[model samples]
Target: MFPIFNIHNVLLLVLFIISALIFDNFRHVNLEVIKSFLLENIQYIFIFVCQFILWYKTGKTEKAISALSDDIYKLHKTFQTETEKKEKAISALSDDIYRTLETEIKKIKTDILTLGETFKTDAKKAEKDISIFKDDVSKMCETSQNETKKIEKEIKNEIKQIRETFQIKIKTIEKYISILNVNINQIRETFQTGTKKFEKDISALKNDISKIRESGQKHSSQAGSNLSLTTNRISTIQNSGYSDTETLRSDFIALVDQRSKRETRGYFTPMLHALTEEISLSFS
Candidate 1:
């Protein structure tokens, strides 16, 4: 059998004995026994009371520490949540900034490309225009050179024709001078051979010849002046780079007509009359 007097049983028996003793004292009214029992267990009772007070104080302290730990944990969790929110806001703001910058950069690149294309087109157009201008200048210069050569050739031919005509007129004037000299020699011979009547006839013949010579000289002078004026007009026209043959012809014809009219009225008719009287006198 197991031992019946274990620690729990012994404690129970002690508690029962103490209870009976208190009961018996209370019933018999024994104050001294009661006082003696209390004195004997005083240390045990004081120790029990002190242990209970310590347990209560330890429980209260544990509760206060738990509540403080809960409050600290709550505060830490709130801080973490606020930190996460701030991080999200910063990330969102960074994304927005990056997107804005990227869009602006794309637009700038597109504009730069467009500007480059425009410059290239303008450069090509300018090159074409410059080429055309150079071609035009070359053509104009060639045309001017051709025209100048043609004008020079025409002027040379005109001068040659004028010179030929002038040479012919000079030859005709020399022939007339020879004829006048022959006539003057014939009059001198007649004057040396004749008497008073012959002297009168000779003087009249000399006067007639003098008049014819004066008229011939005047006609020659007028012809020379007209020739010089025509030459001057031709030179003026050539120097001015004009070529109007029709106008020159008209002017020449008018001058010739006027010269012919003057010669007929002033010299030719009088000369014919003088020649006829001289022939009649010579025959008589």
Candidate 2:
């Protein structure tokens, strides 16, 4: 009814026709004769049409299924290739990261070792410097002590020499004083004798007495000036802290010799000698 041309429909129509032809002569003929008639007059054209239709539908369906399977296989291959590439990239990145970390760690370790060595070297240098400083200080202290001892010994020797020189000067001064006393006594005795003989030689005795007095005055003044000059020299030497006793003694002796020379050349010495000769002449 719906224009059916399938193999099953054609097959059904052929069976109906064969059944109709066989039933139509069923009372007047045998069954074998009817089947022979159907075989000879059957429509083969319908069977051919049915087989062509079936083959055409099956070929189209197989082509569609094959094409779909090929597309699915291509998609699977692409996904697998992308996955492998991603895994390789990740593996490479991991290796690079590990190598970088290892290099950095090694560099840090080397730096730490170098720093440790530097610190050790600095510590040793500081210790050596401290030892040298201590030695220098010790040497300075020893030298200072030695210098102090030398200065002390020199001062003691100077003091001893000064004392000996002072003693000698004191003895010389005492002797000079004794000689002056004896001369003064001799002068007094001559004056007393001259006074007792006043009428006989008054003018000559007066002249001699005046000359003696003048000489004494001049000698006293000269002695006083020399004593003052010597005192000033001694004071200057003491104030200056002169340490050389031999030099001091030599200067003192030079001063004394100069004074002796001055006295020998002065009027005082000749006047005193003339007075002594006059007294001897008077007695003669």
lDDT of 1 at 146: 100
Scored by lDDT, model 1 comes in at 0.66
lDDT per model vs. reference = 0.66, 0.67
Cα-based lDDT at residue 133, candidate 1: 99
Off by over 4 Å in 1: 1-127, 184-195, 198-284
Candidate 1 per-residue C-alpha lDDT over 140-193 given as tens digits, one digit per residue, 9 for 90 to 100: 999999999999999999999999999998787566556545644654454344
User: Candidate 1: lDDT of 206?
Assistant: 60
Q: Which prediction has the highest TM-score against the true structure?
A: 2
lDDT of 2 by residue, 68-148 (tens): 888999999999999999999999999999999999999999999999999999999999999999999999999999999
The lowest-lDDT stretch of 10 consecutive residues in candidate 2 is 240-249
Per lDDT, the best of the predicted structures is 2
